[model samples]
Target: MTVYPTRLTQLSLLALVVVSMVLSLTSAPTMAGQTYSYTLPQQAYSQSRARDYQVYVPDNLTTPAAMVMALHGCKQSNADVLADWGLTAAADQYGFVLVAPFISSYDGLRNENCWGFWFDHHRHQGRGEVEDLHQIGLAVEDAFAIDPERRYITGLSSGGAMAVVAATAHNEYWAAAAAASGLPYGEDAASVSLTGQCPGSASFHSVSQVASDMAAELDDDYPIPLMVLQNANDCTVLQTAANNIRDGHLQVFGSDGSSQGNSEASSTACSPYYQDRHQCQHTRYTENGQAGQRSLVETIFLDGPLATPNLQDTDHGHYWIGGEHGNNGKWSVRVGPSYPDIVWDFFDRHPKNGSTSGFPVITLIGNNPMTVNLGEPFTDPGATAEDSEDGQLSVTADCSDVDTTTVGDYFCTYSATDSADNNTTRERTVTVVDPNTPIETCEQATASPDTHIATGRAYAGGTSNLRAYASGDNIDIGGSFDTWSQVTLHEGVPGSWYSSEPAACGDDSNPGDTVCTDWQDTNLNHSLAGRAYYAGGYFSYGGDDYLGAVAGLSSWVRETAPGHYQSGQCP
Candidate 1:
């Protein structure tokens, strides 16, 4: 008889996880790899209670491979857990690290080998099971180079319950976690005793009740992706347990315009598991992060009509059992699905920064090996940067001492650091050259003197009756040279015409006291009448009351000569 799934009712709120994979591989013989055990550095399981787990390292283990911490149900060993998931060949083919941690088997009467999934002692923080698992994952990180965004956790039964608890409490440490046949966490929630057999009579709390408890424990803003796998006819852990898990996830992951569209998945077979008459349907809900990237939460339903205690473990399918009709397993319970591919595909899409390396890239622009003329302006060509986490980044530049005015080579550096502290830089060389030929001579300018016609002579006293000197004679204003002082002193001669002022009268014959000798006018006119003036006039020897006999309606003018000024600079 096949058990059909009851229609799920709409719950108020909950959660999201990774995208599915499409890779198809044949289920080859289980090539058992080397499984090694690791001991906890510090005592976490229980004081004095030794804690250790085993990991299967494939022969072809590559750098930065994805890791999955597969947890086993009660009475299951690490090897059994790995075998149960049917991931040995898949791990080899997909190139991932498969880790199966056997829950520390305590000597206690109650806390034996089973994970303390639903217990008051394990619910809260501080020296507890959840903290221990987180530390172990961190330890695993230290031991391997697994991608932070590719690290995940999945389990069966109580181990499944622990997966849910660990993922929610410590979302920062994991990329995603899928709990197969698990229960909602919290001390108040209903639970079953691991000491008993499969399908114990334990009543599960309502989905809302579980959601309320989770809402209190988990941060409302913490939206990590979750994938819940439910077995419809599960009696070992009832179908309602899976429903509660799904509803709680949906509630915690609010649809407050923060999340993206939903994707529904259905497949006849994925690999070794689903091939043999098993059915699978998946629903993936995602949210666009502030960077417009993807964060997801997915839930898968694996159930179909099968008899009670179905020899294939079909009815109480407490495992992720599906495959592409390989129909290859020692027992009906062992053979099933292509879970690894679905998981890998999902993890591939969601990194801390949208399938990116969580870093920024800096690109340089403008002239490289730039050649510029001396004295010419050389502007720095800048750079740009981008980061998936921080989006488009701001950049700054530094030119390595390039003198555009002087001829030389220089380097310009462009750099930027994203918000995530990812640094990027680029450099360019700039060469400045003086390409113009040199010049020898430059232009020159000079000035020459012109004739100065005196306005009149500046005299010591009045000169009356001296040819009736006009009012214009002997007048000085505005500091203008009163007398005809602007005269051409012939190369060696004192003056042919000097201002007749007392001290400057070259007409006098006083030795060393302003005297003149052999002086001639512009027309070779020389007067020896004790004192000579221009226009053929003469002032008497002693007291020339005529004030040196005014010049002929005196007037003055100036002239200049051509110059020889040089180019580049005035010479």
Candidate 2:
């Protein structure tokens, strides 16, 4: 169901938090000694579940600029996110626009108004919560400049789950995504309660299953670079469920399990936001075949308690952790002191690699309706893909089943992917046909009755192959000289001769129709009967009598001339 905000949009006077790129890269997020507020319009865009949101611009770069959206966890407000998280801090340091959005109240939720993560929910693409958030993005674009290449989104807890969905479903919009303490593909987020006491319940799945399912959901051609922020000491969210954020992305990127690419423990002198020494770990993964070539996904693990005591009025529950506390008061801070600086450094490195757009587009090139002659060689025109960012893409066509050697409709398909992770596809079809066969000339003379045939070709001038007029399929209705099944030599006849199903011969009209009965029932004709045997061959309009049942077949009595009767018996 589409989520509709309970209240209509209301216009308000502008209050924008402005930041400067001139600020030190290693410093924490700050207002940089200036604040400007712009009045948001009554509405940004229409959505069933639309709601109010706030935006902070670091600097108004008239050219396209980057935009980062953050979603809060349960019982958390847009205001709370802006105050506690380092996204705003980074927005100031990097001169990017920061967006804060709200979610609806979840049913049976442990925290009030938490983001919803039901198993049945449609969490991909422009549906559900992502749709609601996208409208807010459109509003931000309309209000300020947004670099199409640098758009990014991240979230915490339940919001973290939402972030992954938004990125996976609509990868074209986000160049990269960072999910802090959330499950990818929404696994294990749904529960009877918010607490982590019963994580092993059947309602949740194993790390491998979660990783596999989430990986299967992603499009290989459009994998958005991801950073999974996890805490080593998080007690509220189990380490297994949380780690899939990184594992799932690696699986999607075709990684075989993984190994740590970077790690730092007990590093001091890291930030202005923290007085305590910082501890951090960075794990990186690359695509399977391209290992040591390009890193596709990474995870940052920090164990921390907020170094800046009383940064917020409340306690540090499930918050970023630093050096371990004696009471273990809160989970380790996966995103430690000066989180924005470290996070931004990673984001800055992975921009859109292919086209400026999301995925590649493909086009099939060939005759709209193609044709191939019987026994002729055919080559498919195939397809090609073009990406604005990645340029021309690699295409592969599958034509293993195409049989131009025989007459039939054959389908050939092509697929392609660009470096930027976009994909496109196209297909073409070729119809095989034989213009004529040797069966239409019914010029056989009436042979002497009861004459034993010596040679097989004596009956029809040695040209026994005839296309069945009733079914249009080639059938061996004559003697050893006939080989219609091999080359469709009987196409001269109007109607198809044989059945597509070889079993149709079992239903052949008994007696005279028993000769040459092993015809394919392509036309589904079950009434092929009445033809007599020539040269002792048992042909079928549809008969199963195989071992040369020539007794009732020699009686072909169709009279061609007024005075002479054509005989089924060969003399």
Candidate 3:
């Protein structure tokens, strides 16, 4: 047995020693992805003691990256946050870090776990939990290469409630924040009564109350932009609660500007005023749909004093993860470019300390000719400038020299200036042309259907009166066609016709009268069919009903005579 206690025994001894050493070494526990979970120091709270959070850091850390803290809802764990949100993939793709903290419960029951803070109560109640979150944020900054300026907080349901609380309470720490299916403020006693025993009422606070408290903390000169997302159909948080929070902000900021119009009926608009007297856009989203269905409301707030409102249709029931709801209140997650992209875009646009430099481009309507006259007043184009920082826009035009006499091209330039002094100029062109010309008097114009005589067509022979109608451009002349002008005709050679004009023929002096001479030879042959004929002279018919080659008498030569005379003689 002196031969080193059998090979198997020696290996077993070695394994035991190794296990003991590992237990003593304080190594982190490994999880699903080989990620390590560690615990921080515990803190005390009103109902329970706070525990350190578990965070997952990607291995691809090279440079500093944005940090996103995803808090868990009531009765949900760090692991639940991870699994439900499935944000690891997004973190990997977007090159950001993720941290999830646990809100330990008094009861050992894991399902009782929740974020310690409440929306409708005093912040002091959740001191331990808030401290833990603050520490966790600081710890993340220390543990990972985090861009302090780009830190963000987002969550779902209860978690979302906490995220809003954290972001609004600690605005200095977070660049931007988003909450899904979360109330803007905590539940009050009345709200609790309405919704039944609100489980997270310990630290609930009204959004208006919170805003009032936070007013002092906010930069009076420039406040941070806050974006809120809520399900119109969220039965738990109730969309009205969120509206109260937004209204509080409006009251503090002073609603001195117009709200941007939106089509979503459930949405309300508000604006925030900065110290610079500029208006920032703020909007509230709410549930809007028939009962028993899903709907969504979203709102964005800018940094200015004035608010602009925009809205869109969204899904209901706490859909921050974005997908169909699974069995256990879990949402089936699907990653998209929009969520992370919007997060980054909003973060990029709004900086911590009133810096609008390097913001994204926003285009606004410039002054253009909505209407223009043919030649009268000269119109000039106007434009205004837009900037990522100072959106103040004003447009001016130089229309003093617009030429009305010339029928040619005219150009007007407009200059725009924003609050930051950024300028943009645009020009619009207008053209003037002469009014459409009227057809010459008595000219032949075709008539459709040939049922009634049209203006500008000639009439030859018979009792068919040749009428002349004239239409004026840019002027109005009143009278019926029968009163304007008339023409008459008479027989010349057998079957031939002669026409006469009122003034030209000495017989029919009345302006509306008609006379006939050799109309077919004079007017019909000279112009096309349907052309108006200006009879030059008058003529007469046979005696009684027919004056033979008689002078001074005029009659219209009817192709069909009244008596049916085949030859030239009255019965």
List the candidates' TM-scores in order: 0.49, 0.48, 0.43
Ranking by lDDT: 1, 2, 3
Q: Which lDDT value does model 3 have at 392? A: 31
Candidate 2 local lDDT, 149-179, one digit each (tens)? 7778887767777788777766766788877
lDDT of 1 by residue, 1-571 (tens): 1111211111001121111221222222445456655654434343323346666666768878778887776655564554435566657755677777766654334433677766655644434666556655656666667777677788777778988887777665667777777777663234552323445456777766776777766643546667777667565666777667766666667564332233222222322233233565655554432332344466666664334211223344355553421212211233333455455444544554345555555544433456788998878756655564665578888885888888778888777787767786766678887767322111111111111212111112222112211111222111122232232211111111122232222344665442223222221121222222333344322222222344432222111111110111111
lDDT of 1: 0.50
Error of 2 at 206 (Å): 2.6
Candidate 3 TM-score versus the reference = 0.43
- With candidate 1 superimposed using the best TM-score fit, by how many Å does residue 425's alpha carbon deviate from the native? 35
Q: Residue 284 deviation, candidate 3, in Å?
A: 9.0
Across residues 1-571, which tens digit of lDDT does each residue of candidate 3 receive?
0111122222233222111111100011212222335454443333324354555555565467777787776545676555435455445544567777776543332225545344223232234454456656776566557776777787766667677667655666776676655555444323321232322122345655655665643533323444564434444455565565455444444333212222132322221111121122233322232221111223532221111110010122334432111111233222211233334334444545434333222221222222344556643323333354444345676655456566666666667666545655555555555454221122222222111122212111222323221111101011123343333332222211223221322344456543222333222322222222223433222112232232333323322221111112222
Q: What ordering of candidates by TM-score runs from best to worst?
A: 1, 2, 3
Report the candidate with higher TM-score, 1 versus 2: 1
Clashes of each: 60, 69, 51
lDDT of each: 0.50, 0.49, 0.40
